[model samples]
Target chain A: MVTAREEILERLERARPPAAARPAAMPEPSMPIDPMATLRDRLQDAGGSLQFATRSGWTEQIQWPVEATTLRHVYSSLNAMPGRGVGLSSKTNHDLADLDVCVLAAEFVVIENAAAWQRPGCLRERAAALLATHLIVVANATEIVATMHQAYARIAPSDASFGWFLCGPSKTADIEQSLVLGAHGPRTMSLILLSD
Target chain B: MGHRERAREFVADVDRTRWHDQALWFVRSKRDQAADLVPDWEALRDQASAIKRSALTELPELWREFEEHATAAGTVVHWARDAHEHNEIVAGLLRDRSVRHVVKSKSMLTEECGLNSYLEAEGIEVIDTDLGERIVQLRGEPPSHIVMPAIHLQRAEIGELFAKEMGSAPDLDDPTELTDVARRDLRDRFLKAEAGLTGINFAIAETGGFVVVTNEGNADLGTALPGLHIASVGLEKIIPQQKDLAPFLRLLARSATGQAITTYTSHFRGPRPRSTQELHVVIVDNGRSQLLGRPAFREALGCIRCGACLNTCPVYRRSGGHSYSATIPGPIGSVLETSRDPATHAELPHACSLCGSCTDVCPVRIPLHHQLLAWRGELALSGHHPAWRRFSLNLVAWLFVRPTMYRLLGRFARGIGRRLPPTLREDLLPAWTRQRHLPTIPKSSFRELYRERQRQPKRPRPQAQPRPRHERNG
Candidate 1:
């Protein structure tokens, strides 16, 4: 009896479509003169916000007025953000439901969609950013890329296991098309752009 | 039942029907706003369609490349010829680990394969984590819409269901309140489940990995605890290169919803480092290869499951997704259901007014209306049309063949139209006349008018210059 794979291959061979030429590479549209300024606007559109801070002062600036809840900084790189916050582990996955705020460092940020890239090491407990009611990321202004293409190109060196392009806080419009934040994830995502 | 009967039933409640129509129209408007933001929107769609075309043409090669790379990345790859085999492979994976509980996030393929029922029959409990999916699962109904699984339901209906299932407040009708209830209820299931399954949005052959895009972040949460992550992907989801994801990613969120991007676009290259985690990809070909064999219907594979076609479709917006009575619904579903069983889905092709709005909004530019037309022709050729339709069509064809007869018939129609009352004319073609007016017949036929003009010499009236304002007043 022919295997499913061979059968499928045979059918595909029989059903070959007519030859079609590959589309020419699309030209990237020109970016705004101030990509960071545009990025802030787009971030707000996507239910995320941003604040500018000095590189050294970003840690000090990471403060939330919401009281009585857990705050986590999951990444191991202390010098990256220079913060001392509660850490997240796999064991915390069960109890992170009440997490109020989290501040971690993004590998790189995409300006077009305001997506923050998180590589594997810092994202060890995947739920750290997601479970929190509010998430804050501090990244150097130099790490911002103009588009997703640029962001994808920069991921080759990270050896990421579960890399992500987190655009905004978790949201859902499934209920009568009403936009609601904090749907099984962070209600707010605030990025601190640390200028050198 | 035919689309007309089902759609009529769906629209029986006029107020709810209007609400449904406005709701989907809102989504379509949002899509327009998001799509306009990209200057290269059409270019991205073109590239995406072209990439999908090549991917389908060279699927056998890409599948092998994906498998090779995925296996080398410490991921196990499995192939299933059909739904039964696909369910068995997943069941086998779970049995090997003695896993009794599984958490799943919005994989429509599993719904297609009847995986949940199959797993439950084998004594494993499965929980759907997506807020919309969980709602319909508790109600024991299939997803009414592909993207918004419970779109057919109202918030009050959901509130009632949640009250019973999740033990929430009985009178809870607010969307956010109900959503919070679901989140609190499913949080423990995500952490305790032994295995997690998700659907693939795009499977990159170059990296031997896949991407799962979700706004709720349920997939990430579900797979965080369980060391085993099983991604059930259709063969058509495979793209030739990793870079090909750029155009698809840009179009997906904009077309699906108005969002700039989904909250999370998670790229799982391999299983995480510890906890004996493993990434297993089951690439299923059930009926897809057969679809690939038909050139006329081949473009359907280019669909990205955005449901933009559904939102813009007048028929779908009015009739609702459930009226199509297929796993996937709306214009795309109408054509796709025909492939599964043309006789059963024969009425679906007739559901459209053929306005072609679906094609206009399609991210991959699948000629959905044209495909539906083809399905109609094929169905007619197969003699699946009702006897009255066949007879009427034959009568029209016969009348058009004879010039004199056709002219006489036209004259008779004009005479009848002049003599008949408006209400009688509406009864003649109830379907067309129900919501619109019939056109008035002209006093004379075009042929007669042309003959009369030929009998007279052509005369040009004197050109009149425009009068000044004072002269016009005088």
Candidate 2:
């Protein structure tokens, strides 16, 4: 088990951005990923408050905060923001498990795709955290590996973990279509665009 | 609880036949079509799974938020950690409302927790309004399948049962005739029902509504015509929105039965606003909260109570649903039962072929066979297996520890297999192989052949492949 963990760490290291090119100034990437943002905009909008891990903000002083300031900020923005004239978020496969409707201040937020770390091993667990709503994907600008299989091939480790995002403001419409927010889990989720 | 023992009897009773097996397989096929229709079916499953997992991780805050928002929506959200508390709370609510006769649609949770008996004992007459549920209610038997409760019964048996119980003609097996009587009987009950109870399919968090999908349309009538609509649902039924239902509707009905969609998908946001009826939503935990924290059983929540697993399960197909001896039965039933007590359900995990058809058929995609395997580990840890079985398994493992002893025993088994009495080999095998034939053993063991081949190599030649199970002679 220890060896497995070690191997996972080694593979994740290869996927990480080069340490030698660390930015001189980094800020949290907490800005909302314009729900209406097209794929191209999402690809370009991968900086600022989104860089929660390296941020030196007031909220980042905490010890080992896995899901930090940026996520909370984005969650709040998504919560306070009203829905557009559009019907709803069209990119999800919502079923009985997730009610697409969400109460703005819901305690339970459903992150359709969860990744605390970009690695597969902890992504499922990390995205499950209450306030951890961001779904970060490190992808190149070009469509080299659009699918999961191809993504693994480019950076595939014999034991490397892989995961993507399905951010959702978890809700359920189970009770006679009476949309109840936070039936069992988080009521909000905000997707974080990393190297999209 | 009225049919609890009868349910066990029915299971054992039907274990003698394969009627239910074929019916369930048909249901499995329906589910396959439902799943196959959605392009993002796998992604949807993964999202549902991840949502449930995320919910489990943040239960405390989420529950609190649910409480806050639901309360704000004018819903009385009460928490019951167990089945008893859940039932008692519902009973007390009915008692408070002075409800004498309550109409209930099909709810597996109510069965799982046995809420009807508790209500009846409290002097409340509970009527199951759904056609299949009403039939089982009239016969005083438990539902055999999650979707088609009376799937095990042939139309003839149903006709007889209804006649014997409801005083219809004994010879009537026409589905149209039988369905008309049930509909009429339930309609009368629905009109007089003071409290309407239902099992929630998906609870929308954005709106304070709960959705119940049914083919009979009874859930709608029960809740709509009644003064009170009391919905009981496990916490995991929460989905994100109404528009998000396209994929689920495609998957759920097909998975549950094989319909492109159920006859009716009713969404009730709250009690009839401005109407005399009151809406009460009871969120039943009943070990679910505990299960929420558990990783292995967490996926069990994603189940839509579709018994596709039972149809494709060789063990469930042969042994039947009754052997499960739970409110829910079949592959999903056994897996969820483990969340309750490993020692009590020791036989469940063993009663499977682990063929993985259940997972394949599951709309939300729970790793059912893995859960069964995990249950075995739990059963072993709790020291629950029978002595002989454990002894034989251990003894074999110990023999395999010694290379030469294992080979000697293997040869001895081969020798005895070749010379055993024909009748003994045919009729005296274990129950697992009662309908299946034993595989023929070769004169020489594979290891012996491999070792010999190493000493004396021969030219390679292609041979015919082994026949699959369907083609094999049973």
Candidate 3:
């Protein structure tokens, strides 16, 4: 006698009440740092700064310790952005359509025409890159692929350049008719394109 | 802020002109494929949700433990109940240290707090180090999309915006060239910033550490170079341990950008080598404690900001992020807004295809679609529904539930609709349909067919009874 909707409603009704009891054993932040000391240290750490190695490309080094305030400032500023970032590259020889930006997300490295975006596997990689905080487009300067049409030439029939269309974070402003930020998606962008 | 039918109208108009809806829908399909690729996607989602729920359940204790451990590790932890409190604590911490001019990575919580506005008012200049954020900052605009704030913009528009805003060339059209120009602009700010702010992706209760995922390594660089480091996190962001991190980390980047992982998933437990800037964590409640107490929407707290639903939502695709008018937009935006301020965002829940794509796409498995449906009930109970919409919904319900009334109405509609003059009842429909005509319905209702079947003889009809014996069961 139970329709699917009825079963769902019934299950929902049977759902347990929100856990009334808080965990007795709560973990606390081990040792509260002297706020002043932490800041002083942070400013000193800033003296070290970050230096990029051309060989390994964009690698992340957290440094032994990260001051909470310094990190907060970085994150806060970063949060309020969709910076001027675009990934571009030109690789004349094509085994795939469009450049793969997937590797770029973590490696900050751009790969030449490794696979066609129209291809299932290749397209997935490209899509992942577009959604990333930064993008890498690897192509020969002479071989430019910008619009969806140029993409077709590079991608195989099996590979469709769908990922390119969803290039940024997916978002909506359906609440109160105001454009609220970060409803969903990256909220920022960085693109690295190979020039030569 | 709330959803205004007017903004939605504006988006619809633009959507029709640009066909941007199809573009977003394509992203939705990509999300679906990505989800489908993992056979254990649903199970992983369940585990992630369960982990987050468990973490929230034990938040007070975990938070306490985190504070103790982080402090021991040389990090300061501060508790705040709302944006003002969180910002105040942060500002107070800075004032104590004589710190000014902070650098930052993307932190939506700070944005919600209007931290930059607050800081500017407090006579502090803040620099955003993330590339996209810097772009919007230069243009003096709020981000449009979560991932790509300026997604609504074209290269030419950006060129003009930067040119006029940043004193760059007025006609720079190449996205690459413009980006290089901004890089130089932001690099200067980064080097000079005294403090850095980064948002917490996941705050580990056990280790007293936080994770910041970034593709450009902005968080790593910004935090590394700043004199002071501040991480602002909502209370709900805490997770139990690093062991529980794998599933989320694995899912976060891939489900979000289809990557193996983000470029940087840095875990910061303490200040650098000997000392880093004052390491302070503003553990903010800012509406969260109250939200956690509300059972229906408690799961909304588990969100990791992947933005899958926004990409998948048809309505969001057409309307863009501006229409919802909240800090967060899209289907998830509707859910968050409904929970935050029902009256202001009452109309948001209606902007759904009910396709359940959002629910399916969610990495944390928030049951977004169901929550969206639940909002309508919550909104109605709260008396937030518009009178006209309520009446229409009631009228539809009445007719559908009453077969006789429905049949008669169907017949009447068919008769009148078929004979309608060239100039139709335009106002009766949404503007989307003003230019398009609806197909006329047949005079009869499906119920008529059902009645006719019942009227037929009960005795076995030879042709029907035979039913091609072999094929009958088949």
Candidate 1 residue pairs in clash (backbone atoms < 3 Å): none
**Runs off by more than 4 Å, candidate 1:** A62-92, B411-474
Best by DockQ: 1
**Which is superior by TM-score, 2 or 3?**
3
Q: Give the TM-score of candidate 3.
A: 0.67
Q: What is the RMSD, in Å, between candidate 1 and the native fold over all Cα?
A: 4.3
**Candidate 3: tens digits of C-alpha lDDT, residues B257-289:** 444344445566666534334577888766666
Tens digits of per-residue lDDT, candidate 2, A12-49, equal 23322212221121111121233223223222221101
Clashes of 2: 66
lDDT of 1 by residue, B1-474 (tens): 777777777776788888888888998999999999888899888999999998888887788888887887888988888899999999999999999999999988998899999999999999998888999999998887889888778999999999998899999999989899988888778878999999999998888888999999999987876778999999789887777788998899999988778999999887775547888999898888878888899899999999999999888888878777788889989888788777787888888888899999899999999999998888889998888778987898899899999999899989878998987887565231244477787878999999999899988988999888898777
- Model 2 docking tier (incorrect/acceptable/medium/high): incorrect
- Model 1 TM-score, all chains together: 0.91
Q: Is candidate 1 or candidate 3 better by lDDT?
A: 1
Best by TM-score: 1
Cα lDDT tens digits for candidate 2, B1-474: 212233344445444455555655655675676456445667656555555444444434444455555566556766555688779889998999899999998899899889989999999999987666777777788886676676656778778877887788999876756765555465566657788889988765545555676644466556655567788877667654333343454456556655444434555554433445566777766666556556666668777766667777766665556556767778888888867776676677776767887777676678999898888777777778778668876897799789989889889989999888656786663343345677776899988889998898677888979889888766
**Candidate 2 chain B: worst-modelled 10 consecutive residues by lDDT:** B1-10
Q: What TM-scores do the predictions have?
A: 0.91, 0.66, 0.67
